[model samples]
Target: MLELRPNCECCDRDLPPQSAEARICTYECTFCASCAETVFAGVCPNCGGNFVPRPIRPENKLLKDPASTKRQLRSAPCGARTAA
Candidate 1:
C-alpha cells in the first residue's frame, strides 16, 4: 500500500489524503506540483525521474492502515539523487 505521505518532501507543504497537488516521481519521490514543474522542472531531485501526481489512497482504508501518526515530513529518499 502507498504510504500516503503527509507533506511535500521538499517544501514541507501539506499533502493531506485528498490533495490533488502532490506530485511524485517513479520512485515515489514526493513534491508539490508547483515545485515539481517550476522549481525542479519536473525532475525529482532525489530520483532523477519525471514527476507525476501521486495517487490518493481511498479514505475507507483509514480504518485499516491509518494515516501517519505524526506530522513529520521527509525529502525524497536515496537511490537516484540528482543536482537541483
Candidate 2:
C-alpha cells in the first residue's frame, strides 16, 4: 500500500490523507500538486518516475489500514526532473 505520506517531500506542505493536491510516484514518493507541476515538472525527484494523483483511502477503511503519519521531507535541492 502507498504510504500516503503526510506532507510534500519537496516543499514540506501538509497533505492530509484525503488531499486532492497530493501526487505520488510509483515508488510512492509524495509531493504537492504545485511542486509536482511547477518544481518537478510532474516528475519524482527520488524515484525518477512520473507522478499521478494520489488515491484517497476511504475514511472508514483508514480506521483499519491507517494513512501514514510519517513525513519524508527532502533536505537537499530537488534536482533535475527525471525521465518519465
lDDT agreement with native, every candidate: 0.71, 0.85
lDDT tens digits, residue span 1-84, model 1:
667677666667788877899898877667778778867888878758998788877789777976563443444452333322
Model 2 TM-score, 2 decimals: 0.88
Model 1 lowest lDDT segment of ten: 75-84
lDDT of 2 by residue, 16-47 (tens): 99999999999898988988999988878787
Q: RMSD of model 1, in Å?
A: 5.9
Summed over model 1, clashes come to: 0
RMSD of 2: 5.2
Clash count per candidate: 0, 0
Q: Mark the 10 consecutive residues where model 2 has the least summed lDDT.
A: 75-84
**Could you list the CA RMSD of all candidates, in the order they appear?**
5.9, 5.2
